[model samples]
Target: MKPFKSYVVRTNEENQVTHQVEEVTESFLGEGNTTIAVEYSSINYKDMLGLQTKGGVIRNYPMIPGIDLAGTIISSEDPSLSPGDPVLITGYKLGTEHTGGFSEVARVPSEWVVKLPENLSAKEAMMYGTAGFTAALSIAALEKNGMKVEDQPEILVTGATGGVGSVATQILRKLGYENITATIRKDYQEESAKEFGATKIWNITENESNGRPLNRREYKYVVDTVGGDLTADVLSKVDEYGSVAISGNAGGVKLNTTVLP
Candidate 1:
């Protein structure tokens, strides 16, 4: 096999983190039953953290940092996968504890691979990478919990301009949802939120709270990508039998709320 270029992140003895693209061989890849010729990879929040020193994302030094990839198989020891097969990978130890998809070539366990849908190209698959996957999962969970588009329920998607929130908003709109409310931190993001199919744009104030255990029942469903006090506040606003799918903690981890809501 020929050498390929990869984005590598390394930490020094002084704990300084640095990253660069360098040529590497197949031997640099982690142990796996399959090798893929990576066509595309997408950046997620976790990928950013993986590039930072002690960011708590990467489990080892001298690592590649991409959580999602779409590509065609080059070779595989597993019979279930074969050369020329299109596939995508997300989650698992890829890009963290294992050599990830930032490389032109990637080796991952066969169990981590999913055949890409016929309608989706490798580039399109990566565009919906891990962030979009998370958003889709959140929406699926809400639907399973009784969310219905026919009811025209008010759905709130926090962090509306972010990858997950933006995808979720667009997905809901495509699913015929008409009452989507998207929250953004800045006024300027309203247009972007609207472009993502949000029927209403909410300007979220950091650490804003009404000091009550529960506020008015505003939304029937929530796809919260930002955690912390924002989640606490949203929790109080969810209607009875409604659902809130929490997928991130970009805001903070602490949630101070009563059990009433």
Candidate 2:
């Protein structure tokens, strides 16, 4: 109804990308069945790339960049939601192809809104955001693929200090898994990894491969947030009948390894 503040990223005719906080109206929110009072939003890797001129994360110019948001509904055409209902939205083209949550207000298709769990607050929801959701999804997928904690199976979480890995580790611990092994790129991350419930830490640089197509079986389950050579190497070390849930590709996209593992 009134002009509100929004952070906008625009590419000029010169192809230079710039971001600024500016005043906008409800019309700027674009089409949606629901209008929300945005309480919080979190920055993710995609959001960072969206600010770069050539990041390619943004499908169009003059966009908002946050990928995760949590807040209250102001109005909704969807009967399932009410004006004061607490809700959250992640993924689904928010902050990329759509007017996102980096504003005082956001409007999204009601189908995209998720009612916040009774125990979760908007701020807390944002604290978990997309990374935590991805981590939980990875673990759920691993469980669906036959990963179990009853035997105290060894679980490896790559990028243990990162957003997804850290959340994954804690969730595993909360689920009563004890043999959680975390992989990190630096020695300095050891303490933080352990704090996130890693029972052991493996430094990537220290674990050079022996050049074998397959290595000794180590972990029964792996949450691989880092891709590239690390994934190739780790796959060789997973035990027979093991499962690896690959998530992020912060390292690289290529997977150069044999199927023997």
Candidate 3:
């Protein structure tokens, strides 16, 4: 059989990172229970990291950098998964530690695959990818933590213009949450946030930090896609018994806050 095309990332001994599209054979795929004909994949921040000189995301050299993929199963050794089945794979050290979705053909453990739901198409699933999945998962976690849309009408979403934040805002609105506050760093994103179902917009760059240990409670539930000090800020302002779901660390990874709030 002919080699399939794939985007490959390689790092040199001097820490120079190079990315290019190349043809690969099945032998390069390593071991897997399933082989998928990848139809869709999305470019994410992680993908950019893989192309950086010292991004530290790639565990090995000569890798494919895409965390999410949706496609039809070309073959499967696992009894549960069959050929021609539509499936989606995300996370689980995909782009970082393994041959990822940047290739026309992707092979992964069957355990890492999810049967594509009937309501969603392969392209649509890629549109959601890790970003949308994170949003939905964060909201689900909040709900599971006793958060109620009816009670917590004014929920907060940070990094509102981002992939996760935008999808989270829209999902909240669709779920009947009337008051969604989307916090953004840019002024121009306010209207876009509102269009994504945010009723209020808070510009993080324009807003001043009070530097207090705690602040008045404004929201019962908050989705903090951008973590670090921003997460600490959101946690401090959450109402008593309120829940905050933090899914990303784009801002920073460290959380510096008092135990009081």
Candidate 4:
């Protein structure tokens, strides 16, 4: 009913970072037209990077780092929305630049909040989170790029065990994409991928050679999560004018390429 606790990440006197669970007061939150009683938040890969000492995601010291949250508005200054409305929010620098939702409450700009769809709940929204949204964006991008389920011979989803990959696989299946191939490094993720509608699964190694640019027209569509060399490899093996919907840089950020004949 009042102010509450929030987990925060900050830098120490030596400029080394630290993370602690601390009580947050009412005044510290950013200016907002709506106040939300935070209900659920999810651990995204970006959040993991921000939380881990090894992850350099948090650029500013003394920051909160949650990328997604779902809750109900307590009050609203905006006429487009009212009090007691449920909302879902991901992206828009929620946890990066402003106070975020790894807390009992969050006061956020009303524009940052998205009303939950009729069939979806606060809990369901968090379950999908930013990763799922990114997946949707990837598929939507593929569609925009002229890759259609009815036309593509096969669609390859790389990083098949990860959050984006999982969601993409499910959505693709729901969209009736039957010729789906999943590429993963772990043998254990096959069953899970199959559950999501991956008919073919393969374990690819970083060491495996992905011979030559523009290999024998394998995939008409690719949803790539791991970038760097893998992205390079996938690009090379694409069918003429095929599309690769790229979304993450988990493996490596740099992408190098040379055009094929």
Candidate 5:
């Protein structure tokens, strides 16, 4: 009932961006059919961008910046949802084109909300957030393409210390995949990668280019979180009939590759 609080990002006339927690009211919330009393929100890499000067994430000024949130619905215009219903939401333009979940309250399109599963707590759901969901989807896509744990071929995960890659590595281990390799940029990350059940840890140099058009087939499956030339290199290294699921572009955005690879 009282004015709520949120972290808002605004670009000033001087072209500097300021981000801080501030008080807000219902009117400040974005257009949506459902209003939720937010219980938890997780910070992703995208959330960090909104705080930067030229992060290129916010499509508008004075925005709340969280990509995923979980909470209990306080009100809803849609018939399928009602007050006190537990829910979680991600994507559908949240934190990009719309006011996001870094607040005490969030108003979002009803279609963007999903009923929280009975086994998952709101806090637990936020722990998964966008990065974890991305990781899950990446694995699901690989499975849909016929990658199975039973076959037991070596699986590769790029950027293995990152949010998506780390979670993906652990999830793969949990699902009975024993031969998992994680690619890291530094030597110190080998232990961390192993904690995620990576059977082997590779440096970026080992998996990336040495200027070959197509290298020897190495991995049967790859969950690539870094896109760019690395992706092109990964493509060339994939075994025949294998598939790759790419989900991030932190390395770069452009890809130059031949179909032969």
Candidate 6:
């Protein structure tokens, strides 16, 4: 086959960032038991930040920046993956430390690749991406921490217009959660969040406060994708002894709050 094109994020020996969308020969691909002809890749947040002007996401030089990919195996020696097998990969440092999923073809370790499930197609799998995965993790955390439909109060999902929030709302609704409160940044997303099962929607910046140490209880379980004051505020609003699953740092890092009795 001819040379394949890839968007490689390179850092020099001094840890300087460089990005290049160029063609590469197939021989340069990492060696693995399974060689896949990549068909689809999703641009998750990690992938976006990793391919920057002065890339801070990449640890090694000349690495491709993609965290998720779905493709068919072109060659494989492993029993779990044979030629023509459809597969998808996420996490496992595929894009961060290793040559990633952005190329036309990829050679991934068989252990890291998952055979596409019966009901899922390659395109469908990529559509969910890492955001959906995080949402699943958040819901799982909520469930493990004793969240139930009988909790009366709704589940609060912050950053609701983003990828994780949207999917979590859908999943919670599908699981029969009666009330899902979505907190988004835009007024337009209020409608979308409602459609995704949010019975109530709030803007991220709409409710201004005087940094109260505690607030009225509103949520039973909270999925916070935006950290900082938002997380602190959610902490105050959660029902007594309730739990929260938090991910993301787009809001802020240091949280300003005091634990209430």
TM-score, one value per model: 0.97, 0.96, 0.96, 0.92, 0.97, 0.88
Tens digits of per-residue lDDT for model 2, 159-251: 889999999999999999999999988889999999999999998889876768888899889999999888898899899889999998988
Ranking 2 against 3 by lDDT, winner: 2
The residue ranges of model 5 lying beyond 4 angstroms of the native Cα positions read 206-208
Q: All models: lDDT? A: 0.93, 0.91, 0.89, 0.83, 0.91, 0.83
Question: Would you list the clashing residue pairs of candidate 4?
Answer: 10-62
lDDT by residue (51-169, candidate 1, tens digit) is 98879998788898888899999999999998999999999999999999899999999999999999999999999999999999999999999999889999999998999999999
Candidate 6 structure quality by residue, lDDT tens digits, 189-240:
8889999888888876688555777778878898888898888878878788
Worst 10 residues of 3 by lDDT: 145-154
For residues 1-261, could you state the per-residue lDDT of candidate 3 as single tens digits? 469999999877787998899999987774698999999998888888888987989978889889999999999999999889999998888888988999999989999999999999999999988999999999999899887766745699999899899999988898989888999888888889999999988888887567787898988899999998888888778888888999889899999999998
Over the full model, what C-alpha lDDT does candidate 6 score relative to the true structure?
A: 0.83
Clashing pairs in 3: none
State candidate 5's TM-score.
Answer: 0.97
- Decoy 3 TM-score against native: 0.96
| Model 6 misplacement above 4 A | 10-21, 150-153
Better of 1 and 5 by lDDT: 1
Winner on TM-score (3 vs 4): 3
| Span of ten consecutive residues with least summed lDDT in model 4 | 205-214
